[model samples]
Structure formats: C-alpha cells, structure tokens
Target: MRRGCPVVAEPLDTQSLDAAGPAPPISEADRSPARAPFDDLASDWRLRHLLDVDTLSRDEILRILSTANAMAEVLERPVARTPALRGVTVFNLFYEASTRTRSSFELAGKILGADVINVSGSGSSVEKGESLVETLNTLAAVGADAVVMRHPASGAPWLAARTIGGHIINAGDGQHAHPTQALLDAYILLREFGDLGGRRIVIVGDILHSRVARSNIWSLTKLGAEVTVVAPRPLLPVSMTAGAAEKEHPLSLPNVRVESDLDEAIVGADAVMALRIQGERLSGKLLPSSAEYARRYQLTAERVAQAAPHAIVMHPGPMNEGVEIAVDVAHSPESRIEAQVSAGLAVRMAVLFLLIRGGA
Candidate 1:
C-alpha cells in the first residue's frame, strides 16, 4: 500500500495506508512537450550502486529522482511488487539503531522487487569481533547485489562503497552524510519550489553531528541552491568532513555560509531546515543546556516567518517539536517535513533503480 508522510517509528511494524494520495499516471496526453514519460511510468528499474552521495552528479541525481517519481506511481497500483529487481539480493546492514531510515530502506528494496534482508546491531555478529568490512564481505559472498548500511562512524558508507563492489548506499553515518536523506530533501524542494538553484535554504540546529545536514548541504548546493548553516557555535564542527574537503567544494557552489544566530540566518531566507539535536552527541562543553539550546536555536512561528514569505520549513525527522520547533509551526503547510519523508521513499527507490538497472 502507498504510505505517506513518514514519521519516526519505533519498530511498530504497522503501516499507515491512508497518508498518500494516488500518483499521477503516465498518459498518452502526458506525451505533451511538458511531461517526461518516466515521471508517470508506474513500473521501475533496479539500481546497482549506492556507494556515496558524492558518487552521483547533478544529472545523475536528476535521473535517479525521476526514476523515483515513477516508483512513487507504483505505490497505488493493485500489486505493489514488480519484477524490476527480481532475484536481486539487497541487504540492510545497520550497526546503529534506526527506525525510519532502516524501515524505509527495507520498504524501498521490497517495493522495487528486490529480495530484502535486514540485519540489526543486536542480532548481527558484531560481538564476535568481525569488522564491518568482513561482515559486508560475508553478505557479498552469499550473493548480495547491494548493501544499504548505517554505521556509527562517519565516512563508513564511502569506505564500504570502496571496500565492496556492489552499490553501497549510506543510510546514515556518524556526522558525515546521509545521501538518501539529502536526495529526499532535494526532491521535496524540487517538488515544491521547482528548483533549489539560487534559492536560499537555512539549516539550523546541530550541524556538528548531523549526517543529514552534511549531505543536504552538498546536494542542495550542487543543484545551485544558496545554502547556509546556522547554529550555536557549539553545533558546528571545527572543520568540514572528509567528503566536502575531498571535493574541494568551493563556496560559490551553494554560496555556503555559517551563522551563530538563528534569527539572523532566517531573515531573508527562502527555506529553513531545522535539525534535531541528538541527546547522545551533547557533551560537557558543546551545549550550555537543552533549555538554552531550545530558546536560542529553535524555529518558532515568528522566526519561520522572518524568512521570505515564500519560505518553507523543514526537518529530517524525530522532531523535538517543543525544543527545535513550536508544535503549531511543525504542521504548517509551509513545513515540508512530512513531504521530505514521502520523497525519501521516492529518492531511495530511484537510487536502487539506477544502480540495479544500470541506467536502463
């Protein structure tokens, strides 16, 4: 069934079938010069490689999302499964505990017709001292075609991608990049604003430990969006990630900026993304207090409006509603947090299609 507006679920195993409306269909009239047929196609292809978000270029990213748009169509069909990835083996190997990301990756694989295997940290062989690389090799040895991984370490996705031959899609890594999250975020921006190019999008909260923030920064900027990172001084790292440095990412790409004041950052922005402050990452010196962080960095209704009238509010998931956002502000039509979740499935499906179908 087509589900919508992904929220942070804690192994509920129950799905909401009512959230999504049906997708637009590929029609003979859709052949009009304005429409891309793939945007309406109901079936999907398999993707093989998912090593890293950086592995995808702008054109590649567009194509992957277009494919995902089609996969979104399949959600409403009588039978959700297609032969797009029949017989393909995809493994969900997560060393860290996750709810939505893990479930969505599993859902994407199944919806695209790939056999799915979910391996969690608890049941996995980590207690035996088998390194991540060795565990990945074991999966490959058993005929795995792709590995979707979430590790506690940043850059683990890239390392796994290099270490393993199959597509290594990063679910989430330590304070590095969550490529799929970025793709979904970009898709939401694209779906709403048409193009993120030259648009000002501000991300507030914990930039220091957010993989979502890092990936979204890189992805949005590559698409020509003007991006800014706003947080207390404590939320930002002393340096950029290895991925950003490796690319020699010029400031002009996203016209990136860093600010200490959330109020100032929201002023004149087209969009504002509020990031969650992980309780786990907070240390002795990083924050004065959660209450203080809430007061200083939170996106209130007044703050959200401080941006351009066209600005939309966003969050990756598991929102500290009372903390990072006012409850009234989270459900505002301008907030695309739910849309981001929907787009996530579409984006992941696209990545899988591209890698498995090898860009049919």
Candidate 2:
C-alpha cells in the first residue's frame, strides 16, 4: 500500500521508454539522488520559465514526471518536508479565484523550505488600478525568485515572463493554459498506465474555454497519447478541427481528433476526462440549457461502461456536481479525480524544484 491507500497495481517490469529506445540515457550525475529526493533527468536542460506546455520538450516533461515520482515518495513518508529550495522565495499572484492550485503551490513551496507569499487581486494594489506589470515589478523588487500566477487575461503569464526578471509559472491564464494541472494529470495517468504511448484519452465537455483542455492537449500529445476532444458544436473551438487549417487560427495538433459525439468519443477509450462547463467565462448563449448539456455530455455510468473496463475518470474540479459527471461516477473507484488533487502537491513541488534549481 502507498500512503495507507491500497496499491493500485504492481510496478511494470519493462524498462522505461528512454531506456529501451535510442534516446541517450540520463546520466547518474544528473539524477542527484543524494542531494534531492528525486532523479533529475538532464543536467544541461534547464527550465527558466513555465508559461505553457506548448513549448515544453519531451525530455523536460519527463524530467518533471520523474521528479514528481520522487516527490510522491516524500508525500507518503511520515513527515513530508524537504530543504531542496531552502533559500528561494516564491510569490503567488492570482487575479482569478482558485482553491486547489493556490493552496497546493503554497504548500509545495513550504514543504520545500521556501518563503512563499500569496497576493490576491482582492486586497492587493491590483484593486487600486495598479497595472499587472507594475505589481509584478514590485514583487520582483521584493526578492521574489519565482512568480506563480493566475490571471483572467490570456497570455498574462507570457507577458509577465517577458517583463519580469524572476521565473514565471502559469497557474492558469484565461483560456490559454494551466500547465501544472496538466502535469499532475499526466502524472496520475502515468502512475496508473506506466506509459502514455498509444493510449486513447477522451476529453469531453467545454473545450472552447478550458485552459485545462488546451494544456492537456499539448502535454498528452508530447507524451504520445492520442487525444479526442468531445463537445457540442458551440462549446468546441472552431480551431480545434482539421477543417480549421485553412483559417488563421490553428488549435489542432498531431495525434488529436475532434468529435461532437460524447458516446462515440468514449467508446473503447483508455481514459475519459469530463470538463466542467465554465459559465462565468461564457460570453453568450453557448448551450441550450444545463439539463440539455448534462443529457448530452455528462459522464454517466453507462457512458463509462462504453470505455475500457480499466479506464479512469478525471475532472479538473470545482465540479458542477450533476452537470459534467454523475455524482456517483465522480466518487467511484475508477475515478482518479481525488488522486489528482493529492498528486498536485508532488507535481507542483517538482515544478518549483526544477525551475528554481535546474533553471538556474
């Protein structure tokens, strides 16, 4: 058993992909087992800013995963504490509301022995009409080593990265990306399946406005997983399909497919991720009604039965209970939603550690 929870399955006997393939082996010196809790994948490959997964190399994603594995071990211990980032300081600058992302980042920094300061838009100078760049510059002036930010505007983190000297990590930015959430999600799936190659993952629901969906597409594809995004015509982005190639916007990626039918997309899939309908972000009428949306796209038990028997269920939460997923299915054993929350701590820890140390 791991951390008093039943061990999901036995460890895979086969070698990891990098070890089996022609890819260069990660050196022992890069592992840093003595100095840190996890195995660092590469020595020269440093990550300075984490604005989006769209630019992350396969090796960089693997490094974060491997380090997260070690951090998971620390989480399972009696007392989870590490001095990996003892002298570093992190600032959490959130212009939007959050619970899991905010708390986990703060906890991760604390566990790693970093001084973490949280400044939300409500009480901060942002309320006094201070510009984002001005607030970020002020934070940087106070010796912040890194800034984990969530803003209501797309490309906010990218703007901050270009403007600030400190490393910028995107917690979530408008409809652009939430890279670490995608990392933890991939981590959960990696633990369950050992490898993501050839796996079919069905992402169902509001794809048009979900930053989680955007980030997941980039990371999951990079890791060799086939993704099928399912949503109603209005809820799905126009750039998400092959037909959009002729248009200016291009959201489609290799190994990804867009489907309008939820049941068709879930059929024989390895995993099903149901996204919450973000009503707040919706500009105009996108769906007929909440009941209609639930009837068409919700992950009912019957819909889950259509997937592979071992297929997992996921949601990047603040779930709208009976809307995107059946309440029972959300609490079912096949659901990895809860585990994803626990994995967030480790994943965020690995991210902070890598960006602070390796990025240096």
Candidate 3:
C-alpha cells in the first residue's frame, strides 16, 4: 500500500548516540547501495499527487528537475525506453481535448514501461451519465496506479484524489493549475540559464484565463526569477491587481508585476513566454478587438529584441500564430518552444517514475 507520509529521515547524531564510546559499526542493511545518477531522487519523495505547482517546495521541485536530467539521458538512448515502471498502469483521464499534454503524458508512461490507458470525456462513460468521481472510482477498481486528468472545471484533480486511492496528476483544470507544464517550463529555463536567481521572465497574453500564467508565476518566482505578466486590464485577474495601491496582492505574490505595456515589460527579460488566448474560458468580450490586443500585447520580433541579448522565447503551445505571437518570433533562433516539448516529455517521465516506482 502507498504511504501518505514522506520517507525523509532526520540526520543521525552519532556524537550523542554513543557519546561514551564510538558509535556501533554501520549495518549492511542500513547502507544504501551505489545507484545511478538521480536514482535516489525520490528516495524521500512525499507527494502522492501532483495537482499544482504552488504546493511544491523548492526542494521537491529541484528533485523532479534533477531526476528529469537523468530521464533526458534515457531519452537520448537508441531505444529511448526504461523499465522503471515496468508493471505500473497510468490512465490519462482527460475531460478536455489536448494534444501536447495528453500525448506527452502517454509517451512518458509508455517510455517508462507502464501500461498506459487513454480516456476522453466524449468517448467515455461520461457520455452515459457517469460522474467524475464515478469514473475515477471505476479506474481505481480496475487497478489504476495513477490518473493524469484534465478537466474544464477547476479543482477536479483534487476531487479525484479525494475520491480515489490512485495517484492523481493534474494536466489542467479551468484556469487553475497545470503543474507539469510549469515544471517543463522551469526545466527549460533552468537548462538554459543554469540558475533563475535574479533572472527576468516576462509572460504575455491572457493572464486571467491562462492556467499556464498562474502556475508559471508560482514556479518561476519560487525559483527566484523576477516575473512580469502583461495582459489587457480585463484579461488580468482581479487577484493580481486588487492591491494595486500597495503594489502587492495577497494571492498574486510580491515577485510578480502586472504590466499593461508589452514593450515596457519585455525590457531586460531573460525569457518571454506568450500564452494562447483562452476564448473558450472568457465569459464575455474581454478585449476591444483581436487586432487591438495584437497591436498592444502581441509578442513581436522588435519587442523581443528589446529583451536581454541571450533571452529565450517560449510558449506553452497551441499558439495563436499572428494573434498572440508573431510567426517569425515563434520560429526564431532564440525560441525554446520546440525544446519545451522535449523537456516536457523528460519531466513527465520523471514525475511518473518517482510517483509510482521511487522508494517502492
């Protein structure tokens, strides 16, 4: 049975344990065997579910990234497969349509030797009036080791975790959190810059509706990166600008700056991420016009030139070409959009391996 408690142990005090004499000789059973790089990353891993980036500590985040570094090596091999999760089963329970995330998770699990199942809201029993909890319970009844879910409603993964015993990985939940996306984004950034401390990252486009923006704010800020989020006033979440008078919002965090001007925000940035406009999630007309938004906030080649010389360009995907980002900039030499996909695969592989097989 999976234990909810983390495996971390307190450091032993040999000086106090046997102060009168030398400590007892080390026991063979207590000695950890020599292991491959990052094999022990999850030796003390505690999380049973990865629902959001906000809950992950700096150490936990580092562990996942460090492990992903090892997984990247596995991906580089001729076969690009591993027996890490040889007998494990991972179910992708996506309630919303997905291309990058669903495919990435499926590939990650399969690459790790896990039995992966793909389920969609339209094709599943949900069409037959099955509930979210009911669907998760059904998966658990059939020996599902983990459920990576994406739903339109917020907090669906948390609900699934509470309803089932299997590990829960949130793919995305209605402008809530996409932990893996943030992880891969962070991984890509770390790979490029080595350290995020004092680095400037500007996120452009819809902030209120973009779950990627919310999660990125948490992940990047925790890593010591200064983040500036640019969006139209209506597209910006109230939580971010509520305390504008004080220049700090309780939910939005102090490290995050809300900017109305795209040109101003891009200056001196180490990386710039453009978010897809989430029209489906918008309740009403949030922008005056697409052209107006593009004129004001769209990431352009000239604007990118204003950032640091070595700055990288990024997007979470399903990019709106000429709408949110210019075509040339998306394919520019400084763009890490394609690299983010590769990093995502490695990061997901690490997450699946650590959750299901680590410390087993």
Candidate 4:
C-alpha cells in the first residue's frame, strides 16, 4: 500500500517483517544476475508482469535495466520503432492527471511497435461504479495487453495489476514508487558513471511526497551508490516503506545520511536529485512559502557548488523551478532532466515489451 494505498489481497506476515522503518533490506533474491528467476528475462523481452517491485528480486532489477538499456538504443536509432511489441494493443488507463508521463508512455508504446490508446477518468465510465479494476477489466476485454497507469492512490497499480489480465506498468502512483522513473534515473547514472557502486549521490527536497525520491533510492543504493536524503522533518514521511525492502530506503543505506541541512547534504556529492516540492500534500503550517522553501532547500547554483564540483543536478519532469530548483540551472547539460524523460520512455517500453510479449 505504498502508492495511494490499494487494498491488499492478503495480510502480510508481520512477524516475518523486519522491524526496521521505511526502506527495508534488499533481498539476495533481488540482487542482479547470479539469481536465476530474472536471468531468463534478460534475453526474453516478452516477459510479462509489472506487479510490484517486491515480487521481482534484485537480479530481475538488473535484467530490466539491461532490457531498458536496449530500449534506450531504440531512441538513438532512426525513427525509433521496433517490432518487438508490434501490433500489440495497449491501454493508458490514467486515473490521475499527467502531461509528460502519459505522453512519454504512449510514445514509448508506439515506438516499441504497439497499438496505443489513452483513457482518462475525467469524462469516462469511471464517473460511474466502474472501479479502477472495473475499467481496467473492460480494457482487457477490448484486447489490451498492457496498461501504463497513473493513479492518485499509491498502491493502485499493484491492485490493478492483480485485477487485470494484462500487465500493469505504474506511471506515477500517488506518492509511492514510480518504477520507470527510478529506472530511467538509474539508466542515466549508469550511462554517466558506469556502475553506481560507491558513488555518492544526494536527493534533496520533498522526500515524503515525492515518489521519485522513494523509487530512486531503491535502485540507486542497490547498485552500491551512497545516498543522502535532505528534507524538513514535517515534509519527510514519519514512517518510510516497511517490510523486507527496508534496506533500499535512502535513510537506511549504510553510507546514507539524513540531514535537514540542505547545503550539507549536497556538499561534495557525485549527483544531487532535486524533487519538486509537492504543495498539495503540505499540511497546516508546515513549509513557509514557495519563496521561503526556494531560499532554503532550493538547489540554486551557490548551494550546488558547495557540493563536489563534479556533482550533476537532476529533476523529474514539469519541475517547479522557483520551488525545488532555480530555473536557470535546471536546464544545464549536467542536469539530466530531459535525458531522464527520454530514458523513461525507453525503459517503460522495455517494461511493456516484456509484459506484452509474455502475455501474448
């Protein structure tokens, strides 16, 4: 129930759960190839299923990354179309409003050679009793093999993934995990730094409300990158993700440091990812103002320089310039904002290709 809290089908075995707070341990099952479950998907892009990160072990994570890296190659090619998912019918069932995520996913599906359709709740059957599951079922009946979904609820994708016959790829689910965003960000780092192991990276700004931050930490630290989370106490989640995945949380990483001091967090870091301050979730008397937050935690040039000179700046799409980062510097070459977007499509295409091909 991490993303907007989808109803869980079964109660978790709490006794077996690791008592550690948000960001649980990375299972050896999840470790990159050496593990067999995921190794098979490496060559088989037709691998279906985008249920939850919990189900796919670490090696699967690397398998998808390897698959996504290949998808990225498609983006670099002329016209960027592959028959991998050719003629596969797919659906974009977005219960939440989005501009870039929806567009990128639809573009990714089209590029990977799949038939795409978009559905929004604003003026659709969803206005009726059609639950998220109900609508998705209808899509499946109509021949959809995959769904790139964005919902206001956190665990919506997980619930839908189980409810539908087709595979589910979470676009942005509440403040919960955004797997593709995490994957693309990881891809950007992989392309830049080679391997994430031992690299120092800091994610500054709204950790609690930014799904990007949550998902990024899991992928980043898993590959051996050092992580740091800097945010105001109120803005950060009182409790982060729990259960077996605890080790992946940014705060739990052995080398990761949690600091309220923005400047200190960024100092000498290899990369700094600034998450847009989500004003919607801010409750009574929390943050002062956009201007105030910008002045304090905002990644202006001065604060960035306080960190290592080599540190690169990152942000997810539709950035709140004055709020989380300064407008002038957000577009710099070192800023992989757009690159992150491009990689998102490639990685998502990889996810879809796996699911659709398998389901087909």
**TM agreement with the true structure for every prediction:** 0.83, 0.88, 0.87, 0.81
The weakest ten consecutive residues by lDDT in model 4 span 1-10
Look at candidate 1 and tell me the lDDT of residue 327. 91
Tens-place lDDT digits, model 1, residues 233-316 = 666776633335422333444378777778887898988999898776455688877788878888889888789988899999
For candidate 3, lDDT tens digit of each residue in 159-189? 9989988899999999889999999998778
By TM-score, the best candidate is 2
Measured on C-alpha atoms, candidate 3 has an lDDT of 0.80
Error of 3 at 116 (Å): 0.3
- What is residue 233's positional error in candidate 1, in angstroms? 1.2
Off by over 4 Å in 3: 1-39, 246-252, 279-284
Per residue, candidate 2 scores C-alpha lDDT tens digits across 188-210 of 88777768889999999888889
Scored against the true structure, residue 108 in model 1 reaches a CA lDDT of 87
Report the error of model 1 at residue 137, Å: 1.7
**Candidate 4 lDDT tens digits, 54-92:** 455555666566556556555655566655666678889
Score residue 108 of candidate 3 by CA lDDT.
92
For candidate 1, the 10 contiguous residues with the lowest summed lDDT are 8-17
Model 1 spans with C-alpha error above 4 angstroms:
1-48, 240-254, 280-283
Model 1 root-mean-square deviation: 8.1
* Candidate order, TM-score descending: 2, 3, 1, 4
